[model samples]
Target: MKRSKPRLAVFKFASCDGCQLTLLDCEDELLAVAGQVDIAYFPEASRAMAPGPYDLALVEGSITTPHDAERILQVRRRARVLVTIGACATAGGIQALRNFADVAEYARAVYPRPEYLETLAWSTPVSSHVPVDLELRGCPIDKGQLLEVISAYLAGRRPNLRRTSVCTECKARGTTCLLVAGGVPCLGPVTQAGCGALCPSYDRGCYGCFGPAESPNPPALAGRLAELGRGPDEVERLFRTFNAWAEAFRGGGRPA
Candidate 1:
């Protein structure tokens, strides 16, 4: 038997707390959403963690520790619907650069008491360890989109997230094509829409903060970047930024 208002929980593992902050930042909408559901276990907002068989779980962060790997399974069991929000939860985030290197060696170099640390070799997405119902991609995530997702949840419908590229967003905003006009080696063509085509509009290349667009052809974009005087190494570095461990971005902008 379900309650009149569904209970929602927010969980975190290895993250910068950006996405959760985005939820809190939805100031006005948060109040509205609060009326629709019970925010039962959001540690960032409240300390009271009601024992859950949560109706909806909004998870932020990657699984970077052994405990988190186990915890995600617990979360899955408790959550009827699990949505991974942000790059960390969906594509492993910026810290996933460690995936390409020796984590032990890096830990030893960075920490004076490296032996005290207990962590996984790779900072991995939540879905790698447990089944996820939906993914909201971003470093921090957009408040409007977050509200849309929550609204969809309350209404018992699929959240209509756009799968278009940042290039498409640029067109919608009437922002000039920096790739064509400024010859910038933008990742807009292959990157997912969101961030409002932020970087490109500000005279910088899109860094793919939202990861790959639907069926992204990264190699094709790499070729274009190469033509724009970017070397193979440079293009590889570009793909390794925010969503480094994402499957589409993992091959260093190779064909996905």
Candidate 2:
């Protein structure tokens, strides 16, 4: 008897759907991937949905509501391996900035009737609610790396992912450091690799879209920025980007 293909499911919660889109954006590779694994459920791609005991589940988004917190538990129950994709699933994303501010004030700022909206005071990563097998980080994850993750899971091997900084990629590409060349504030030294140093290659500073590296010395980088004439407010804003809630970037001095 032929062995059955592994069932795969893609889930969404409180995200912009950009990460899920990355999977679809794979184009040529996506067709080959579809042939390898059973696309059990992907509502973003099709209206059809399948029931689980799924072999793998790719979850994207933060737990921002009481209902979302409950739903993640159900997904965890059905999934053998749960992988969180994107900054929203891994570090709580930009929406987590609400954790530092008053949610009530934010609601009033956006909505005419704040009382009608039901949302948690803070947006939090998926790991806060359920055990995650892996985390793929980015504002929108890179499709090539995403394919490697899927391939590894299907082959029952550990995914070969790097925890290094984007600066490595910059050096490999022979791109001049923006900070050294033009004194631009860059998160390249501390932001995780994956974006292939795209921004810096085009002469722009990294905006921390891939989040903090495995063990970033953010304070040291902040001091360097200060030397470049950046002030306290700029330093704080630098840390408060895509992965603001990540521990490495958060003010308390721990890995994010």
Candidate 3:
């Protein structure tokens, strides 16, 4: 008997939906992938629905409300393989910036009726509530990497993702060492490789959009930033951008 096609679902909580768009942006590859699996419940792509238990689920957002915290558990129960895509789903994205501040005060300033808002004090990753099989990091994950992950899962193999720092990308692209050559306060030495060293090629520093690399030495990078005239506060702000809550990047530049 022929094996049944796997069911794939895409979920969202609190995000800009850039990651999901990355999936759609895989125009040619997506058509081929679609033939291999059943695109069961991707609201961004189609109105057609398929109920769980799903073979694979791609979640793309942070848990910013109590409802989402509870909802993620339900999604976990339904998915055989759960993968979190993007910084929001893996490290809470830029929204995690609120984790360090007074959320209630910020709410009051933004909303006309803060009391009516039903948000949590902190925005956290999907993994905070459920067990995730994999995490693809980026503000919006790279389309090629996204394809590799999907195909890898279907093939029962690990995705060929690099865990090196963005500095490696610079070296691969023959881009100049912005920090050493220009004295730029770059996070490339600590930030994960994925964006292909896009910023540094244009003479700007890496902003840690893909979060901290595997075993990243953020403290050492912070010291280098200090040498480039960056103070503790400036260094802290740099690490707390797209992947603020990632442990490797956390508390690195705080005063002693």
In model 3, what is the error at residue 224, expressed in angstroms?
1.3
Q: Tell me the number of clashing residue pairs for each predicted model.
A: 0, 2, 0
Pairs that collide, model 2: 247-256, 248-256
What Cα-based lDDT does every candidate model obtain?
Answer: 0.91, 0.90, 0.91
| Per-model TM against the reference | 0.97, 0.97, 0.96
lDDT per residue, candidate 3, 159-243, as tens digits?
9999999999999999999999998888898888988998999999999889888878887778878877888888889888888
lDDT of 1 by residue, 122-200 (tens): 9999989999999999987988888889899988898888999998989998999998998887888888996888887
**Deviation (Å) of 88 in candidate 2:** 0.5
Angstrom error of the Cα, residue 119, model 1: value is 1.2
Worst 10 residues of 3 by lDDT: 247-256
lDDT of 2: 0.90
